[model samples]
Target: MKSSTFKYSMLTVGIAASLGIVSTANAAESAAASTPTIDNVATATYKIGAIAQTPVQSNKVTVNITQSAAFSLTAKNDDGNATDDYNRSAIVTPKGRVAFNHTLTNSGNVEDTYTLSLAQGGTIPGSTQDASSYDLAATNVTYTVYNADGTVKKATTVTGTDFQNTNIVLKPNEHADILISAKTVGNVGGNSQNLTLSAASTFFTNSDTTKATLTNINNSITKVPVFKITSKVSSTLNLNDPSSKVTYTITVRNDETASYAANANNIIVFNGLPEGLRLADQPNLSVSNNATIVPGNEGKGSSSADDSVRVTLLNLEPGQEATITFDVQKDQNETLTNPKNVINHASVSLDLGENQVIYDSTDGTDPKQNTNVFYPAGDDSEVTDGTTNTTTGSDSAAPLVANQRALSIVSPTKKEIPTSTTESTQVTHSVILSNTGKEVEGDKPGEVKFTITPNANNKVTVVTGSVELIYDADNNPNTPNAVYTITRDVNGDNDLSTAVPKNGAPPWTGMAPNSIVTITYKVESNKAVIDTTETTTVSLVLGGQDVPTLGERIAKNTTTVKGLKLVKEQALNENCAASTTLTFTQADVAASPGNCIVYKITAFNDFSNADARFTFNDLVINDTTARFNNKAQVLTTSTSPAFTIRLAEVADANVLPTDNTYGATASSTAVSGTVTNLAPQKYAAMVFAVKINPDGTTTP
Candidate 1:
C-alpha cells in the first residue's frame, strides 16, 4: 500500500500530461498524492444492456396522427384482434347507401399492435408482456359509442390483459389498414347518419422480449361522416308539348355495398295530367341499360364514360325523382283537327298547313263529339238578315200609334239656396223621378247622384245620397263637359270613362235611361264678413227623357242680403244745471249700399223731475246759417219721475217751451245739450247729448 492511491493518481496525471492536460510536473506531483474519492457511487449503477454513452440531447416532442371512419365493434378471440376496437362511431341514414374510412400509423419507435373493432356496447381489457414493469390496461378506462344523435349507445371498460389488440405487433414506419364500408338501410331517396370514435386510454405497452413500457401514450377517438344524406329530387320534364321537353343531365353516384338500380321501370312513379293536358295513350318506353334516352323515342340515345345521358322519359318520377324527357307533343286530343267525338285511335290528327289534316283519338261512343263546332273559328264569318227596307212617308193619319215614357223631377222644385249666415247651415234637396208620360209597374229606382265642390266660403258634402254622377253636362245639367265627367256608381266604380263613355260615346248600359236629380248646397260665409250678400248655386240635372221640353226651368240662383244691427247703446253720465237742456246723439250708418237715411236721434234721458231738459236743434239748414232752432222741446217738471223721458220734436207743441228747462233743479241735473230754463231747481238730471241738423250743418 506504499501509496496505491498516489500511484494511480500519478498514472492519471502522466496520461493527462501526455495529453497536454496540465501546466507543469510540480502540479502533477501534488495531484498524485491525493486520495481519489467518489460521491453518489451507490446511485450511479448503469442500466444493463445499454450500448453507448448518450450525448447531451435537446428536448424534443413528436406528434402522431391517425384518421378513421367506421362503425363500432366488440372484442373477440380472432387472429391478432384488438379488443374493444372502435373502427368508427355510429351512423344513421335516411336513405340509400353510406360509406366509412379510417387511417392508422406507428407513432412510436418500438413496434406496437393497434387494433380497431366496434361493438354495440361493452368494454375489453388490454395486455402487456411485463406485468410488474408495464401496464397496458387503461385502469378502468371507459370506451363509449355514440349514435348519430349523440346518444351513447354503449360504454365499456378495458380491464383484462389487453384493451387494444392482444399479441399483435406494429413495427416502426409501418401503418395499419383502415377499412370503410357503405351500408344501406332501406328505401331510395333520403338518408342521414352520424358516427363518432374516441380513445379512452393513456398507456401503451410492448409484447416483445424486452417487454418495454411507455408512459404518456395517448389514444384518440375520431368522429367519422358526422352526417350524411342519400336521396335527392330530380328536375321536372313536360311530356305534352315538345317544347316542354326538358333535357335533364344529372350526376348520380352511390357508395352502397350493393349495386344500385336506376332505370325507367325502377324509378319513382308520378301519374297525373300535366298542368291542364294529358297524353293520348301510354307512350312507349325503350332504354339502354347504361345509355341515355333521346327526345323523340325512349332508347339508347347517347353514352359516355361519365355515365351521363339525356333520357326522354315517357312517365315522370314521383316528386321528379329521376330525370326523363321526351318530345312532349300535344296529345292527339289537344289538336284542333281532332274532332270532338271520333273513333278511338282514328288517325290522331294534327293541323298541318295547306289543308293537311291529322286524326283524332276519339272513342266510337261519342260520334257527335267529332264535330267541327268544337273547332276553333279560323277566319270564318256569319251573316244575319234584318228588315231595313221601309217607306219614309206617313201614308195614313196616325198610321202607327206608339207608347213612350219620360222622367221628371217632382219632389224638389227648387235647387239653389242663399248662404248668408256665419254659421254653416245644411240645405237638403231631393228629386223625385215621376213617369209623367206613363206609369209602369215595378219601376226600377233610377240612380241619383250629386256632386259639389268646396269653396273658400263653403264646403259641399253629400248628406243623404251618393255623389257619383255620370253625364255629359256641357254646362248642360243633363250632360257633363268633355273635360269633366260624371258617372253612375255601378259596383261603386268611380272610373268616369266606364260610367260615362269616352270618345263621345253613350254611357254604359248599366245606368237607367232617364233620371232626374235636384242638388242643394249649403255654403258657409267667410270668417271676416259679419253681414254680406251671399249667392249659392245648386245644379239640377234632368236626362233627355226627363225634360223633353227645352227651357222648362231656368237655372235660378238665390242671393241673401243681411245687415248688422247695433245690439246695444249706452251713454256716459254728466252733470247739468237744472235750468239747462242736454242731449245725446250718434251717427246712424249702414254697412251696405242702399237707399237709406241716417238720423241724429237722442237716446234715453234719465232726468225728468230735474233742473235739466233734453232737446235737439239745427244750427244750419241747407247751407243757410240759421239760428239754433230747437227741434225737441222737452221741459223739466217736478211731477215726472227719474226714468227715461222721450224728447218731443218741434212740430209737437204740447210739451214745448223751446229754450227753457221748465223746472229742472240746478243741483240734480245731468245734460248733454245746450238748454235754458225759466226757473232753477236743485235736482239731479241726465240728458242725451244729441243734435239734429238739415243740409249737413250742426252746432258745436
Candidate 2:
C-alpha cells in the first residue's frame, strides 16, 4: 500500500491577552502573571493553503477562553516562621493573661478567603493527664486582626466559634497578623491549659471537616504555686510577773494548686527571739496534708542575742499549711530602763528553695526561686527589722511595783425583803471578795475578814449555824478551789465573835493577789418596814495595815410590801372571763385582726397585813385601734369592804400620751379607787371594754 498520502496539522493557543493570560512558559517566567487579572479577550486566526498535482487541504481554528480559578492559604506566626511559630508554653499565675501571635498568608495564585479560630479540645503539652483544658469563652479571650502593614483591621472579643463564622479575604501573596490574648480563670492552678489555633480557607477542602489550613497548634500555660508567711502573738507581756508565758505562732501557706519541691533539701523556717525574752520550752510543730517536719536548732540559751529556733519541712504540697508555736518569758535580770516601754518581740523567716518556680505577672523575666521571706516586713510599723529577711514582733508590759494591794467586793443579793406578820422572815446574801492588786511580797497572803451588824429594830434571832466559804480560781465563781470558814456574828453586834487567824494563817490562808473568796450568810428581820438591812462589810489588812482603798462593801436585806399585786391581761373576745391570757407576742394576735378586746385586772394579796389599801391608776391601753367603752366594774370580797371603779380620764383628746393611743392623753385620776381594810389572802377583779376600728383609720 505504497500510496501518496496528504497530511495537514494546525496549532492554536487560546489567549486572553488583555487579561494578561499567557502561555505556560511565559507565565512561569513572569511572577506578576500569578496575580488575578480582570476580564479581557484576544483572538488569533490561522490558515494554511497547499497546492499539488491532486488535492491538498489544511485546517486552522481560534477560540476565546477565561482564566481558571485557583486558591491557596498559609498560616504562621507573626515572625514569618513556618514551624513552631507560636508560644508553645508559658508559666503564668492564676487570673493572669498571656498573648499569642499568628499570621495568615494567601500564597496561592488567586485571591482567597480564610477563617481563623481556636480549637477547643486538646491535651496540654508538658502537662499531666488531669490538667485542665483551655477555655475558649469570649470573655476570657481577646483577638485582633491586622493588615500586612500593621494597621488594625478588626478588634473583637469573640469566641472561637464566632470567629470561624467570619470570612477574611486576601489577595495573592498577602498576609495578616492576629493577636490572640487569653486570661486564666481564678483559682485554676496545678494544671496546664492548651490553646489550639486553626486557619481555614473557603476554597480549601479536606477529608476531615474539622481541619483545614492550620490545626492542632498547641499554645499552653501553667499556673505555679505562690508562697506566703505570717505570724502572731498570744498575749501582752507582764513585766512584773516572771512566771507569765507568751506564745508565738508562725505559719507558712502555699496559696496555689501547684505542688512545690526543693532540690536535695526541704523548706527551712527560722525564728529569732527578741531581747529581754527567753525561750521557755520546745516548739510545737504541725504540718497539714502530705508533709514531714525536721527539727533544727532549738533555742538553747537566754544570754545570746542570736538565740533562734529552726524547723525544716519536706514535700509542702499545694494548699497546704504548716505552723510553729513556742513560748517565751521575760528575763528577770534583764531590767528595762523604762519598765513600761519594755517590748517582747520575735521573728520568723522562710527559705524558698533554689528551684522553686514562681509565676509573677509584673515582670517577664523568670527569677531564681531561691528567695527568703520575712514575716512582718520592714514596712510593718509594729515590728522592728534586723535585716531584709528578718522581722521582729513586739508586745509591751506595764511597769513593776512593790507590795501593791487593792481590794473590792460584790454582793449578788443586795435587795431587801419585808418581814412577815405571823413569823420572822429569813434572807441570805452572797458576797465576793477579791484581791485586785499586784503580787504581795514575803510570801504573806493578804488578810481579809468580815464584820456583820444587824438593824436594832429587827435583831437577828440566830446568826445561822455557820457561814459557807469558797475560793475562786481564775476569777470564775462556779469553779471553786477549796472550802474554807466564814466568821459569824452570833448576836446582832458590830464585833465578829467568830474569829479566824489572818495573813496566810489558819482558816483564812491562800488569799494571794488576784484571788477571790466567796462568803454566804443568813439573817432574820423581826419588825415589818423596819431597819432590816443586815449590813456586812469585808476588810482587807495587808502587811499589818488596813487596805485603805477597800471601800464600804455593804449588802442589805429588806422585805417587799405584802399588800396587793396587780396583773392585767388582754383578750380578743368580749367575754373577758372565757378568753385566754394574752401572751404578748405577734403570733398571738396575728389571726384576730378586729379587736373586740377586754382587759381583766386582778389585785392579789397573799400575805396577811393590817390596814392595807390597794389602788390602781393610769391604766394605759396602748393600742391605737382601741376605742374604750368608758365604763369599768370592780368585784371584791368582804361585804363591807370599800371599793370603786371608774372610766380612765384623759386631759386632751388630741395630744397622745407617751405609751397610749394617738388621740388619748395621760391621766392622773385613778381608774379604780382604793380598797381599804381588805382581809388577808383576798383578791379583787375589774374589767374594761374596748373595740377595734374596721377602717384602719385609728392605726398609729
Candidate 3:
C-alpha cells in the first residue's frame, strides 16, 4: 500500500460553544453570554521511512459557534424579597400610585435587547392561563417603567396595552430591575386587581424559527378608610311649649365593609345652624367603645352668638358609631319671609382636619351645581340621620318651617238645641281667630276657613257663615288696639276668605299679627260626632301675587240636632158609616138597617233611605165586613147581607189599586186591590160599600 502523502485537509466547521443556560434567568443572576466559535484542527505527521521525508497532514478540522437567544422576566416584592419571583403582591391606595418591582435578564450566549409590556388579566403565551380571587382588567390602567438604579429609560409613561415601542438593551448575562407603577381609580378601598409584566427578546423577536419571552404577575388591593353619616329631624316644631325649638339627631358610622373599615382618629362633626335660628340648649353626644367626645368652647351647650356647633370624637374604630342631638329655636330678631324655610348643613372630618373630610354635603352631590330640598309645611317626614338615609341628597337637613305666620281658634262653646217634631232648628258655633305668627297683609293675606262637616244625615247641615273681623293696625292683642270692625255673610263657602266690605273696598284682606277675628259659624250637627276642627290648610293666595301659608288647626264648638217622631191611632166607631156626620171620629152613633156601611183598608209605604229608588212595589190590600155577617143578638148586631164589602173608591193622593176600585165587584162581600209602584212617603187606600140588609142592632 502506498502511504503517500496521506494528510488531513484543513477543516473548518461551525459548532456550538458552551451554552450558558437552558432555563430562564432573572435579575441579579447570570444569563448565557455571547456565542463563541470552537476552532481546532487535528494534525498528524508520518515520515515514509523514518527518514527526512516530506511531512503530510490531513486538513485541520475547524468549528465556528452561533448565537442562542434567551431571556427572562420576574416580579419582585417590597417586603425585602431576596430573589426575583414569578408573582408579587402589593396594596394600592385609591386615586394614588402603587408600584410593583420587576427584573429582566438576557439569559443568552449573545447580547440581546428586550421590549417591556404590562397586561392586566392577560395570559402567558404557550401556557394555560389562570385566574385569581380578583381578576382586574388591564384596560383603564396606566403604568410607567423606571430603572431600579434611578435611570430613566423611557421618559413617557405608557397606559393600557400599548407599550409605546420602548426598548431595553442589555449585555449578555446581564440583567436590569424595573418598577411598574399604576393608580387605582374610583375604588372605595376594598377591591383588588391582578397585573402581568412581560419581557420579549429583541435579538430573535418574532423570528421565523425561534422566539423567547418571560411573563410574571403582580396582585394589588385597595386599602383606605371610609365612613357613613346619618341625620334625622322632626317635620314640625313643638308649638305647645313656649320655647318653640326644633330638634335634630345625627350619627356617624364607620364603613361596614371589612376592607373599608379602617381605623380613624380625632373625628370632628360640624353642624352649621341656618339663619334665623339660635341654639337653645346643650348638645347630647354618645359613642361606642374606644371613642370619646371633645367639647368645644360652648361646653356642649349653645350660645346666642354662635352660628354653628362643633363636636369631636377620638379613636373611632372600625364599625363603631357615635350619635349627637341638638335643639334650635327661632330667632325673634331675624326677619324673614312669611312662608319661608331654613336649612342646616353639616360636615364630618375624619381627623379633625377640614381637608380630611369623610362625609359632607357635597360628597355625592353635583360639584358644579348645588341642590337642596325644601319640605312643605306639616310634611317633614324626610329627615334622615345622615344624607344617605330617608332623603336622597347629602349636606342639607330637611327643610324646617321658619314662618311666624300662625292662626288658631279659642273659647269654643258646646250647646244643644231643642225643637218641635215638625220644625227644623239651627245651631251656631263661635270662636275668636287669633293670629300668633307674622302680619297678615292685604296683598299677601290668606283666609281662615270655617267648615261645617254634616252628621251624614239630612237633618242638620251647614247653611252659611257670619264673620265679625276686627283689625288691629298696631299689632296688639288689647281690646282698644282693634280700631275697625266689619261684618260679612259667607254663604255656603268653606275654608275661604270672607266676603266682607272694608269701607266698600270689596273685602277686608289684611289682619296684623296677634290680632283677633271673631267668626260665628251657622252649622247644623245632627249626630254626636263633633266636627271640632274648623281651620283651613296653610295654602293661601291673595290676588295671585304672594302665596301664603297661615293657619293652624283650631277646635270648634259642638252641636246636636234631634230627630222627628210621629204617632197616630184610630178607634172603632160602633155605628155604621151612614149616620155619622164626622168623617174620622171615635164616637158612638146610631144608623138605620139597610143603610150603606163601608169598610176601608189602607196600604201605607214610607221608605226613609237616602237612596231615591227606595219604593213599595206590587202592593195588595184586602178588607172584609165580618162584623155584620152574624145574626142579630138582642139589640146587638145585624144578620146576613146587612153590610157588603165591595171595591169602592176613596179619596187618596195615591189612588187605590187600578183607578181607586180596590179590584172587587160592586156587591162583593170582600174587597181586594193591588197598587203597583207605590213610592216612598206615600199611602194607598182600599174601600168597600156595604148594603145594610135592613140589619142594624136597632133597625133589625
Candidate 4:
C-alpha cells in the first residue's frame, strides 16, 4: 500500500447570523438538541510514483450546541400600526370593545413555547391615571393567533376554558400575530377599567424580563360597553313625538365572539319606535367593507303594531360593521301633553337556518341601562343637547332610553336601632331620596308622598321647624354650631307630607337631577313594652298629580327592646390579709398559700331599656361547674371540719333582713341567690369566697 500527502485547506464552523436568525437556512432544521450524536471524519489522498492509491481517513469527531432561549414582543393596533400612546391605547364607552395587537418572535436557536395570560387591572408603564378598577365579575376576554399572512391558523380562540393548554409554537426567529379582544364588563355608563396581558416561557425561563402589557385607557369614554349594535340620538331631545322630528343612527358590527361561526340565513332588524313617535323617513341601509345589506324588508307603519321600521341585512362577515339610518316625527294623535321623555330602541333576530335552531334576539341599549343623568322635555342644559348610550345588542343597537320618569335607590333598604320602653321615648330615622330625572322632585304638594303607618304602640311624625342643626360650616372639619332648618309636612289625615319649599328648608322644590333629598322623622314610644318591637311602614311615591306614576318604594324601620343582664367578677383575698375588715377590691392581684378568692355575682337591668316600667320577676340563679371544691377552706387550721359558709347582701335589694330572695345557698363549693321582683334600674347581689390550703395540697 502506498500513501501520498496532499495539501489541505483549513475549515471553520459557525452559523450564518449567530444562531436561529433569518440569515441561516438550516436554523429551523437543527433538531438535534442536548442529547446525541453528529459525527465528522477527515479524509486524505496520497500518491506513490505519480499514481494515486486509496484515500486515507481519520477517526470520528463530534460537536454540540447548548440550548438558548430568548424572545421579543411588539404592540400594534387593529390595522397593525403603532399609535401615539406607545402603540397600545384605545378609548371606548360603556358596552363597547377594543383590541390590543401584538407580535411575538422566538429569537432563539430552538423551537419553544410560552404561557399566555390576561389580567383585569394594573397601571401601565406610561399611564397618568391609576390602574382602572374592575367590576361585575365580568372577565370575558379572547385572543386569536395567526401567521404573518393570516392564513395558517392552529385554533379559533384561546378562551378561559382552555387558555391553560393553549400555546404558540415557533422555531428560531419565527413570529406570530396575537389579537387580544377585551370586552367591556357591563352597564358601567360612567366608569372605566384597564387590563394587562402577559406571557412567560414555559420550559426555559432564563429570559423572564421580556414580558408585560401596559396600554393606558385614560381617554376612552367608553371604557367598557356591551356588545353588538349601538344607537345614538342623532337629532335633538324633547321633541313632541306627535309633531317633533328626530334622527338616530344604529351601528351594527359582526364580531365572531362564539367559539365557532355558525352559518345563518336570516338577519332582520325590527325597531318598535317609542310611543307618540311615528316613522317619517324610510331607513337607509349602509354596509362596511365586505358587508351586504338587502333593503326589501322595510315595514314602516304598514304593520299592525307601532314598530314602524323593519330592514333586512345580509352577508355580514366577521369584523364587518353595518349601519341603519332613519327619521321619526311626533304623532299628531298622541295623548301625552306635558313634557315627558320617550325612548326609541330596536332589536335584531338571526336564524341559523339549521333545524330547530331557535332565533336569537339582540335588544338595543335601553335608557334604564344607560343610567346616566338625562334631561326631560328636551333639556337645553350644557350636556350637549343629545346624549349617547354606549351599550348595544349583538344584533340590534339599544337606542337611547328615554321615559317621562324613573328613580333609583342608592342606599341599603333595611335600617335598625336599639329599642327603649320608656313612654315618650324618642327615636329618629333619616330617609334620603335621589332625583334621577332632570326635574326638581317633591317641589309640588303631592309629587312625593310617604305613607307612614304606625301601630298603637308608637307615633310617627316629621321633624320640622328650627331644629338644633349640627353641621360642618366653620371650615373646622365637621364641627357644627350653625342651625340648619328643614321643612314640615302638615296634612290633616295624620299623614305628614311635603309642601312647596316655602322656607329656606328641605322639601323646597330645589332637588336637582341626581341630587339627594333627606327627610328626618321621629318615632315617639307611646306605650312601648319590653321585648316588643316598633315597626313603622313607610311608603313613597315620586310623581306629580299632573303626571302619572314615575317611581314607588316601600321601606320598614324596626327595633326590639332587650332584657336583663348578669355579671360575675372575682378578687383575691391575699392570704386573708384583710380578714378583720373583709374588704375586697375587684382588681389584679396574686394569691399566696391560704389566700381566699372572693367571688361576687350581680344581676342587673339597663336603665335606658325599661327606665321606670318593666320589671324582672321570680328570677333564679344557679351555679354549677365551680371547680374550687378541693381547694376551698373546709377544715380550719388543718385540724377539724370547720366548713362554715357565710352570706351577705345589700339592704335595698331585700324585702327584709332575712328575706328568702336575698339569701343564697352559700357553700364552700358553690353559691347562688334569687330576686323576687327585680324592678327596672335595680340590681341584686350575693357574695361568697374560697381559700387555698396552705400546704399546696387539698386537705381531706
Q: How many clashes show up per model? A: 96, 6, 34, 24
- Which lDDT tens digits does candidate 4 get at residues 325-398? 66665554553333344445545455432111222233313322221211111211111112322222233222
Q: Once superposed on the true structure, which residue ranges of model 3 sit more than 4 Å away at CA?
A: 1-72, 77-96, 105-112, 119-163, 169-175, 184-195, 202-211, 218-226, 232-249, 258-269, 274-276, 280-304, 310-345, 348-700
Report the candidate with higher lDDT, 2 versus 4. Answer: 4
Best by lDDT: 3
Tens digits of per-residue lDDT, candidate 2, 334-393, equal: 444454333333222233222233321111121422222211122112221111122222
Best by TM-score: 3
Q: Per-residue error at 102 for model 2, in Å?
A: 2.2
> What does candidate 3's lDDT look like per residue over 149-204, in tens digits?
54544434445445534477776556666666564444334445566666666555
Off by over 4 Å in 1: 1-403, 410-435, 439-521, 527-535, 540-559, 563-687, 691-700
Global lDDT of each candidate:
0.24, 0.39, 0.42, 0.41
TM-score of 1: 0.18
